[model samples]
Target: MKKIILSLLVLVLAASCQEQQKIAFVDNGQVIEDYQMKIDMEAKFKKQDEAYKRKTDSIGQAYQLDAQQTQLKLSSLSQKKQQEGSQQFSQKWQLIQQQLQYEQQQMEQAFSKEMDSVIKSVNKFVEGYGEKNGYTFILGKNAAGSVMFGKEEKDISEAVTKAINDDYNGKDSKEDATETTEKEEDK
Candidate 1:
């Protein structure tokens, strides 16, 4: 009975050691920002942003010119007519400003929504990669503030960036293999 109990204790101790996990840390922010796909997205956004700004500026300049013309015409009117024209001009100006503000807000919201979708897709790819590679825990840079201590080897930033870019580029492992097999079969 003592021998049997000793054997069971040894087995439990061995199992406990075997269950120890390997952990890796990554700077997820750096990975995302430095990713090739993310850079392209940023460039696209900047291009669209410049175009939007140009359009907004043109509208603003036209509005200002129209308002100036209305003001110029105000001096030629009777007092009662002048008051009514001034009030109408105020209302129109307010409405135009409000509309511009709302349009800018809508553009920002739309950009945010699209960025959220892209980030979610990147996260899903990371999760799938971790699972396939048997990683017990893949910690983000913010996980424990351990990534900012200047340990270059501990940083998996490049790997995460490459993985994300590769995923975004649709270089799927199985798809590539299947395509190769099909080509060979065709030949």
Candidate 2:
């Protein structure tokens, strides 16, 4: 009877000793805001987007000018020449439209590729951080949506964001206080 009791006790203690790992989920949307590399990537993307927009707008304006010139040339042509010119202009316009579409698709793919790279970097960083910090799991949330059903304790969004920002900013509490003092003196 004592042997059986000891066996049971040992089993219970062993089972209890196997710690259940803690898992946490962070709203990666917020984390991205504090992630410096992600911020730099976004800034680069914005500049590329603006440049693409300007190029597309220039192409559109060129197309409009060509159309206006075609209209004028058509009026000055003989009826037969007008028909031929119009047909040629229509074919050229169609080709230009196709080219524009291809360019837009290329731009979109490039942007998507850049965004994917940024996301992958962020994911790798988060995974390494979680492992180092003893988090069994870390889940990313959609930036466009809200977390409707996570347990409050498991939602480490704020902690993750704060930690990331604090690390990224590189200004510890003491540095921040000193900076504040300097600013006050300057004022």
TM-score of each: 0.76, 0.68
- What does each candidate score in C-alpha RMSD? 7.3, 7.8
lDDT of 2 by residue, 114-164 (tens): 778767766776676576566677777775554556775676666555555
Per-residue lDDT value at 124 in model 2: 76
Q: Which stretches of candidate 1 lie over 4 Å from their true place?
A: 1-12, 143-152, 172-187
lDDT for model 1: 0.71
* Cα deviation of 173, candidate 1, in Å: 6.1
Error of 1 at 163 (Å): 1.7
* Residue 103 displacement in candidate 1 (angstroms): 1.3
Candidate 1, number of clashes? 0
* Per-candidate local distance difference test: 0.71, 0.71
